[model samples]
Each structure stands twice: as C-alpha cells, then as structure tokens.
Target: MYAIVEIAGQQFKVAKDQRVFVNRLASEEGQEVSFDNVLLIGDGDNVTLGAPAIDGAQVSAKVLKHLKGDKVIVFKKKRRKGYRVKNGHRQSLTEIVIEGITASGAKKAAPKKETKKADAPKAKKATGKADDLKKIEGAGPKAAEAMVNAGLDTFAKVADAKPEELSKILSEASSRLAHIVTETWPKQAKLAAEGKWDELKELQDRLDGGIEK
Candidate 1:
C-alpha cells in the first residue's frame, strides 16, 4: 500500500518503512508525528482519493534525526553602481521513516481545553507607558504603532531586530510605511536604549532620512 501525504507544506509518495527527508519539524528525534493531510491511498487495485484531504485518514512517522542541508551561495551585483553582496544559506531538514498508514477509521485526537480558575476575574488591559519609537529617525507614528503591535514596544527590542525583520514588519503593516528605510533604525534604537542621546544625535545627523549618507 502507498499513500500521498502532505508533510511540511510538501507532498510525497510514501510507503511502509520508507524513509524520507522533509522540512524541519518541531518534533524531537524519536518522536512520532502524524500527518492527516493524506491526498490519496492505494492498495492493490483499489484507491481512495480525498476532495482536499482525507477525513480521519492519517500517515504516521517517527522522526529519525534533524540535520541541515548543503549550503547555497547567493550573489548579487549592480553594474557600474559598485554594489555587490554575497550570502549563503542552508535549510534545516528532518529525516523520518514511515511507520504506518491508516486510510480511515482512525479517531482524531481531541484538543485539550483550558481550565480557567473560578476566582480569577477578567484582566484589564494594560495602559502602561511604552517607549516613544517615533523619536527614532525614519519612524513615524504609523511605523511606531506597527512596531508596537508586532511586540517591539521597547527600544531594546527594536535594537535587537535585524534590518530584514524590520523590513518585513513594515511591509506587512501598510503601503504608506513601506518606503521607510530601516538600515539605521537598529543602530539608532541601540543608542537610544543605552541612553546615549548625544551619540544618537550625531549619528542621525550623518544619516539622510535614515539612510546612511
């Protein structure tokens, strides 16, 4: 018997005792994981297909190990601009062996329910003060609000964020704030978090609208 299952956003044809490598899962080694998104199951001449995914059908596997794939180099260049960048990346992966495949009659696991304490009343929302992120160069009220909403409410949090992460957050926020440059936000936030206002001022003066001038 064989089954087509979706694992970690990818699909694969798997059979009993077959070993497969997939995107990294949160499960630890030797832990069992089940995939309920089975698309099709076949045995001999009989086959069952799901409209989207089979109900109650599941494919079980045991995580064998977690490892990183080979590195891939990324190179970029702009002609006559004296701009070039090079980077490398490796993808995390998990190896698993198929243990069993159940076409139907498997009971889905029940979700655990939270037990609220009877003595606890509804908690009030926090109205406490947060850092004024707008003080940072290139950050406006909308950008600050977006950062706060994304849990970067403190200068330290903003300082610890990478430029790529900050760009992703701003892009998800709104188009009005999409054009804002973040190359120097982390540096400025780090200075602010350290209470070095004079140094931050000097740095901002050298920067043109948050871009290194």
Candidate 2:
C-alpha cells in the first residue's frame, strides 16, 4: 500500500519503510510522528481519496535525525508571500522513515497523549506558564508570538532550539517576520533559563538586533 500525505507543508507519496527528508519538525530524533493529512491511499486496485485531507487516515513515521540541506545563495523561505534573502543558507531538514499507513481509524490523539504524559510529571503546575520571549533582541512581538505558537513557549525550549529551526518557524509563521535574525536567541534564552539575568543583559547589550557585534 502507498499513501500521499502532506508533511511539513510538502506532500509526498510514501510507503512502509520508505525514507524521506522533510522540513525540520519539532520532534526529537528517534521520536515517532504521525501525519494525519493523508490525501490518498492506494492498495492494489482499490483507492481512497480525501476531499482535502482524509479523515481518520494517517501516516506514521519515525524521525531519524536532523540535518542541513545543500547551501544556496538565494535563501527562499517556504511560505506564501515568502521573500528571499541575499545571503547563503542551508535548509534544515528532518529524516524520517515511514512506518505504516492507516486508511481509517487513524488519529493524532495517541501520540499527543503520550507526549502530554511524558511532560506532565516534571512540569505539573508549570504547564500553563510561558516565558516572555520578547526579551530577546530581534524577537519582536511577531517573532516571539510565532515561536510560542510553534510549541517553543518556554525559555528552555528556545535555549535548546537551533537558529535554523527558529528561522524556519518564523519564516513559516509569516513573511513579515521572516527577516528577524535568530542567531543570538538561543544563547540569550540559555542565560535567561539559567536565571543569569546579569549575563543575559550583558549579552543583549553587546548584540545588535540578535546578531553578535
């Protein structure tokens, strides 16, 4: 059986055990992720299609690793109204191998539940709290809001995030926010997460719009 599914804004024809490289996702390496936007499924002579996306039809895959694509001179961020940068860039990608395709009775709740359970223990009441990301230079209201919407709501998550990942998330969120430099965000976030206000302020003072000076 094979399925056509949308993953990270791109559609692919995938089958069991087939490997694919997709845009960088929030999932960690070795994590299992499912795409519910299955467009069509085919088995032998039988086929099923979706009106836009197939409900209860899902594709499961395992994240292998994160990597960078070939460098390019014209950096084209993928989004409607996306603009190009005049500098070189390497696209961030995630390698995944399709595990299975379910034509029906497939939902994203299972994995989400597991994720919640995994996070519930340590966070407890801290779940609802989010850091004020506007403290980071160049991460204006739009950029900060974009990162929060992408599940990097906490300082720790931002601290651990790569600049490329942040850039992709920002670019995907909106074309207007695409140009915000994120190079110093993680470093600033790390200091903030560690409660080193003095150091973070010093770092911010030395930065020029999130770029090291």
By TM-score, who's the top model here? 1
Give the runs in model 1 whose Cα sits over 4 Å from its true position. Answer: 111-213
| Residue-level lDDT tens digits of model 2 in 2-79 | 999888768899999999998766667999988887899999999998998888998999999977789777555656
Which residue pairs does candidate 2 place in steric collision?
A: none
lDDT of 2: 0.80
Task: Write one digit per residue (lDDT tens) for candidate 1, span 76-109.
Answer: 9999999999866566678999999999977786
lDDT, residue 76, model 2: 53
Candidate 2's TM-score: 0.53
